[model samples]
Target: MNEELRHQAYAQLEADADRIVRLIKVQMDNLTMPQCPVYEEVLDTQMYGLSKEVNFAVRLGLVDAEDGRELLEKLEVEVSKVHDLYMQEEKLESKEI
Candidate 1:
């Protein structure tokens, strides 16, 4: 793939990661314990896939390390944000009980 195409794919993958994080947060907010285990497994799988894609893209010269790092950093930020939001929601829910 061309550089532009590779970048676009990276963006899509990042979005997918963010979306998965959001879904996990939603599941957590509702106190869904059984689903949390499944979500954790899925998150691990997706993270591995994303890491492989980053390596492949860099190796193929579709993207440089700096570019890949930036994308990964963005993903990290999104994941952190979602986790924080979920924790806050959980705290609020607990207070209501």
Candidate 2:
């Protein structure tokens, strides 16, 4: 693949990951609902969309299943770091009292 196209692929994969995260949050929140007809449809659509993007990305060599897993791991690590930073800030602010 051309270098520019490879970069494009990376950007696309990143966007897809962001979208998947949002959809998952929606799914989780909806699980607490008593009865939500739209929940299932929304989840199903998001899932199918994610699968399609993954398939395309894999076929194009932008990301394999292992690569996807690695990306998710990195995402988790980043989120954890942010959470820890927030907690530390809260602690420091509390100490200022």
Candidate 3:
């Protein structure tokens, strides 16, 4: 792929990652429990879509497999952090009740 196309692919990947992170944050912030079924469904679908995008980039030679894996790992870490925060808040709320 040409440099421009490679750049575009990277940009799209970054956007996808940001979108997922934002949705997670919004759900966590607005919901009492972060484990809502609808939220889980949406998250799963978004994650699958992002994985497919990364796979396509790898297949097209726009990104390396290792790099794609790293990108996903970073997103996972962010999601985990948000989840932990949500759990902590839930614990605090329960204690207050």
Candidate 4:
């Protein structure tokens, strides 16, 4: 694989990951709670799309399999952190109410 192509693939994947994070953040801020069915559906769809992208890149020799897996793992951790924050806030609000 050409070095430039490899670099572009990796960059694009990272960018896609960032876009998903932003989307999740927007949903988290202005839409349904994390545990809502709609929220879960969106998250699942986005994650599945990203996983397919990663698999495609790996098959094309543009990205390593482990690297793609790690990317997904890191994104999951980030989403969890965001969800946890919202959960904690919900708890506090409930207590106040």
Best by lDDT: 4
C-alpha-based local distance difference test score of model 3: 0.87
TM-score, candidate 2, is 0.48
Kindly report which residue stretches of model 4 are placed more than 4 angstroms away from their true locations once superposed.
Answer: none
Residues 1-97, candidate 3: write the lDDT tens digits: 6988888888889889999999988987876356689778877898899999999999999987888999898888888898898899889999999
Judging by lDDT, tell me the better candidate of 1 and 3. Answer: 3
Q: How many backbone clashes does candidate 1 have?
A: 0
For residue 69, give model 1's deviation from the true position in Å.
1.6
Computed on alpha carbons, the lDDT of every model, listed in order, comes to 0.71, 0.61, 0.87, 0.94
Give me the displacement of residue 67 in model 4, in angstroms. 0.5
Residue 33 of model 1 has an lDDT of 45
lDDT of 4 by residue, 1-97 (tens): 7999998998999999989988998998899998799999999999999999999999999999999999999999988888999889889999999
- Candidate 1 residues lying further than 4 Å off, grouped into runs, are 1-3, 22-35
Superposition error at 83 for model 1 (Å): 1.1
Q: Give the winner by lDDT: 2 or 4.
A: 4
Off by over 4 Å in 3: none
Report the CA-based lDDT of candidate 2 relative to the real structure: 0.61
**Candidate 4 versus the native: TM-score?**
0.94
Candidate 4 positional error at 38, Å: 0.4
Per TM-score, what order, best first? Answer: 4, 3, 1, 2
Which candidate number would show the highest TM-score if scored against the true structure?
4
Q: Per-residue alpha-carbon lDDT of model 2 for 1-97, expressed as tens digits? A: 6777766876777776677556545444445231356655664575566567767777877666776666656655654454455557657989999
